[model samples]
Target: MTGLSPDARAWLEQHGFIPTDDAVWLEALTHGSFNGSGPADAADYQRLEFLGDRVLGLSVAAWLFRAGDAPEGKLSQRLNALVSGTTCARIARSIGLPEHIRLGKQARDDGGADSDKILGDVMEALIGACFIEHGFDTAQGLIYRLWAKELEGDVGKAKHPKSALQEWAAGNRRAPPVYTVTDRSGPDHAARFTVEVSVRNVGNAEATASSKGEAERLAAKAFLERFG
Candidate 1:
C-alpha cells in the first residue's frame, strides 16, 4: 500500500511476506475500530489473530522441543512466556510494526497505536497474513527470526515474575503479596489498568497494563525489582 514505508515493505519482504492479495495484508494491519464504531466489515485482524495464535504456539513448541532437552514442564513455562502479549508487543515494537497499523481517527488520537493490546494483536495478525500469503514453513521461519532473542534468553529466567515473587515471599516469611486494582481508565475497547503489589514491610510497586492480569504481573515484577 501507498502508506507503507519502503523500510516496512522491505521488512515484510525479509520476513517472506509478499502479498499477492494486498487486501488481506491490509486487513491484517487494520483495527476493528478503524471504522470508529466496530469493524467496518469482516476485514479486520481478529480472525487473523486467532490463526496466528495457533501458528505461533505450534512454531514455538516445535522449535523449543528441538532446541532444548528440557522436560515438558520447563518447556511449557518457556512457551507461555515467549507467547505472552508482553513479549509479542516487544517483538512488534522492535520491528516498528506499530507505525504500519491503521486506526480510526478516534482510536489513533486515543493512542491506540501505542496500546500493547493492539500491537500484540497486530503482530499476530501480521504473522497470520504471512502464513496465508506464503505457508507454514515460511511463517515459521519468520517467527523464529522475530522471536530469536526471546527464544534464546535464559529459560529459567523465563519463569513468571508472579511465581518468583510468591516464592520470595514464602521464603522470607512475609505475607503473600497482595495485588489491588488501583485504577481503570481509557475507553472500553482500549482500557488500561493500574495495579499495585505489596508485601508487608518489604516493599510495594505499581504498574499499568492493558489487562488486569498483565498489570498484576507487572506490578509483581516491579515489586521484586525494587525490593527483592
Candidate 2:
C-alpha cells in the first residue's frame, strides 16, 4: 500500500506533530466509501470525525470565551463560522490534505479527494487522532494555529450569510428565507448545484457551487448584497 508522501510527512513535522501510531493516522485519512463491502472497516474516520466535531466545538468555544469579552451571541457566531465544514475544508486544502486522503479507485476518479465533505470529515478525524495521541492541549494548540487568521478577522461578520439573512427577515417581520435547488449538473464527483434563495417581499438570489451548502451560502450572500 502507498504510504504518506514525503511532503505530507514534512507538513506534519512542520506543524509539530509526529504520529506515534501510524495506523491511527492512516485510519483518520480513510473514507467510508473506500470500502464497497457490507460495512466499512472499524478503523475508518467516521468515529474519529464524530469525536473531532465535539473537540473542535469545545476548543473554539473556550478560546473565543477567553480571548475577549465578546458576549455570548458574538462568541457563538464566531464559533459556528470557525468550526464550519467550509472552514475545515479550507484548512485542509491549505495544508495539502487532499493529497493524503485514501479513497477507492472510483472515488478518486470521481474527485472525492477534493470534495469539501470528505476533506472536512478527514480534517476532523485528524484532529481527533491528534487529541488521542498528543492530548487536548496539543490539539487545541493546533486548532488555534490553523484558525488564527479567521479568528483575527471581523468576528461580527463571521456568521454565515444564510443565518444573517434569516435574522434580517425576523427583525423585519418577514417570512423566513426559502431556498430551492434550481439546477444541478455535472458528474457525481464534480457535480454543481445551483440554489436560489427567496426572502419574502425582499428579493431573490442565485448561486452555484460544487456543494449544496456552499451554493446556499453564496445565494444568501448575493441576496443580502442586493437587498439587505
Candidate 3:
C-alpha cells in the first residue's frame, strides 16, 4: 500500500515520523471529513483517535508517575494537563501537523486543519498508528520525545486559572464566579468565543480564546488579575 503522500511524508519525516505501514499512517492522517462524511469510517482517524487518546493518557501518566514522587493528586493533575486536547493541539502545532491532515475540500476550506479538535485528534491518531504498527515501547518513546518540554516545564506548580478564581471568590466571601459567553464567531472547526467573568460586587473582566472553556479560563484569569 502506498504510504503518506509525498509532502506529508516529508513533513512527518522532518518530525521523526517515518512509517513502516504507509497505508495505516495515511489513514491515521485522514480526517472524518476527508470524503464529506456523515461519520468517520475505518478509513478515517476517529477509531484511531480513540485508541490514541488512551495511549497518550497511559504514556503521560506513566511518565509522570515515574518522574515524580509526588502524591497521586499531583500526578493526576500533571497527567490531565499533559494529555488534554489543548496540549495535544499545541504539540501538533509545534510539529507543524496542521498542513499534514488529509481533509475534504469543504473541511479544508472551513479551516478544519487548524481546528483544535481536528489537530488534537490527528495527533492522537498518529500516536495510535505508531502504537499499532510498532509497539507500546515505540509509541511511548515517541511521546516522551514529543512531550519532553511540557514534562519538564512548570505546569505542575501553576494552578489552573479557573480553579484559582473559584477559590479566590470563596475566600473573599463573594458568590461563586459567573462566566457568560458573550459572543461566538467563525467556522465550526475554528470558532472563537468571548467570555465575561464576574465575581458579584468584586469586579468583572473579559477575554477570548479558541474554545469556550479556554475563553472562560482566560476570563477568570483576567478577573483575578484585575480584582484579586
Question: Candidate 3: lDDT over CA atoms?
Answer: 0.85
Q: lDDT by residue for model 3 over 1-228, one digit each (tens)? A: 345667887877777666877878888898866756423443888888999999999998888878869898788777878887789999999999988888888888888888888898899999999899888888998999999999998755578889899999888899999999999998776788999998888879999877898889889888888898
Error of 1 at 72 (Å): 2.2
lDDT of 1 by residue, 1-228 (tens): 334456666767766677667677878888988756544463678999999999999999999999969899888888888888878998889888877787888988888888888998999998898899888998899899889888888644566889999999999999999999999999965889999999988878999989898999889889988888
Candidate 2 stretches with Cα past 4 Å from truth are 1-8, 36-42, 155-159, 167-174, 184-192, 200-202
1 or 2, greater by TM-score: 1
Query: Where in model 1 is the C-alpha error above 4 Å?
Result: 1-11, 37-42, 200-203
Lowest-lDDT window of 10 residues in candidate 1? 34-43
Q: Please give the RMSD to the true structure for each candidate, in Å.
A: 2.9, 3.1, 2.5
Q: Tell me which of candidates 2 and 3 scores higher on lDDT.
A: 3
Question: How high is the CA lDDT of each candidate model?
Answer: 0.85, 0.83, 0.85
Best by TM-score, which number?
3
Give the C-alpha lDDT of model 2: 0.83
Model 3 lowest lDDT segment of ten: 33-42
